[model samples]
Target: MVQPFSQSRVKPEQNLKSLSSFNEAVRLLRESNSIVITTHINPDGDGIGSELALSRALRYADRMEDSKAGLHKPKTISIINVNPTPRNYQFLDVDNEIRTFDETRDAPTILQADLVVVLDTNHPMRLRTMEPYVLRSNAQKLCIDHHLDTSNFADVYLIDEEASSTGEIVMKVVEELTSHQIDAQMATCLYAAIMTDTGSFRYPRTDAELHRTIADLLELGADPTYIYDQIYDQWSPNRLRLLGNALSNIRVLYDGKLAIMTVTQEMLSATATTDAETDNFSTYPMSIAGVLLGVLLVELPDGVKMSFRSKGD
Candidate 1:
């Protein structure tokens, strides 16, 4: 199962150790002529949003430089991912620039890039089949992530586990790149990334600063109510039936402290739903009154998939 984007947050000051590396990353971006940007497989909001925002920022910066230098050649900035963007996130890819990786088709593009920016996750394994090709490339790797690094594969790791989301870190980098200018598109993507990862500003890491950042995003043309509805409210009828089918199998355990819900392929077929429609199904069990921990078991063709959500440590 895909993991939730939310994680523990450290103080922002704790990330100061990577300041030098962050500077190096920015310098590399300035020097590189061709760049490739990628995120983890089955990317969630943070990964996709950060990638889009960074792509836009880099292109804008490149255009600005071209204008100043009186050069007409364009910098190639490719935003490729191991998995196709999900339906819900297609709105964020306004330019239709995001591409799905294919070994034969995208291999040359990945290899020829002067720099590759891996966002949201530092682990190379998250790159899936593209990991080997990325490793083979002579391109310098830069990671901008909020997750704790278990493996250091990138040449420059601009990691900040305290960041509310990778988009938050990308926001700062965009500011540096574009001289503190964030357009409506950048604002919308970053706002969605931070909002979803912070559980709609209800999560533990959502501080006053984050709220202020959100306010800035709103001022930049991010519509809070509309974005929220686009992400959460536009569920299909089949999805609602699938949720009902899963809820019908809910069971209590350990004196109501634990709740378990199971959804089989048969249930999906019966409800005329697909795995995509079942997004956030794990949250249902956690919403039970006395349930401290919720577990969702989904039966897929490969095997049974499990997701766990807990209220406390």
Candidate 2:
């Protein structure tokens, strides 16, 4: 669905022929006065975590390395989110550093950037209300994502579809940005990103490379059990009730090849459950042998949010 070019798209790997562009990107960041970084709308953990880690790396290098004969701290790097994240990601504490801004109120701050880095989004429309500022910013733009389906709207776009998660891309960029080892906080951020995107190491995307990276993260202080507990263990009693209702009301479609569940506004009100609690409500159907796809139809105040997940053949 990307435009501005045709079937002859220049892949990131293909574009890596010149070290000049790569050096230009790093230099641009190194010279930027004020940076405003953001991710696609509905930022998942991978996007959020990458923005934080990247900013951290840039700042770390600035703090330790002097730009002109070791005399400057670089500029400020601001991380913004198009919208709030799912509750499970709250544990990341990205709110403390990156700061989330409402586009309605903070238009000026968004437009006045020397550099804009958009993460995780493939389609340009996915940038949401912040899209205008991204376009208007005379500042350079960079795209760091893991989706092959991307629009080269930025100057430096490093995308890798083979990556298990955007966090992996972030890891590579972090190493390039700074040689410093991953700290506990960095490991925690990365672990959250990789774990969620790869379905806790259960997704088919999880390969040896992913495992090796995760092992390195573990040595750097990634604790799977604790992070899993924080991400998945916390549940409200009403959420349990909602889960039960969802499982009971689910239907097998496509002659038991697909499973479907619907969460009406009434169901939400009845169980005192918010939208976040229904994260895995469709998984019950996915566990069934014949079901290859599980779809959840959630009715919101205005419209509906549809979630689709594929399992087996």
RMSD of each: 4.7, 5.1
Off by over 4 Å in 2: 1-24, 66-70
> TM-score for all predictions?
0.93, 0.88
Candidate 1 segments whose C-alpha is farther than 4 A from its true place: 1-16
Residue 300's lDDT in candidate 1: 89
Candidate 2 accuracy as TM-score: 0.88
Q: What are the lDDT figures for the candidates, one per model?
A: 0.85, 0.75
Clashing pairs in 2: 66-70
lDDT tens per residue, model 2, 96-152 = 765666776656766888888887776667877778878887878877677776775
After TM-score superposition, what is the CA distance of residue 253 in candidate 2 from its true location, in Å? 2.4
Report the number of the highest-TM-score candidate.
1
Error of 2 at 240 (Å): 1.7
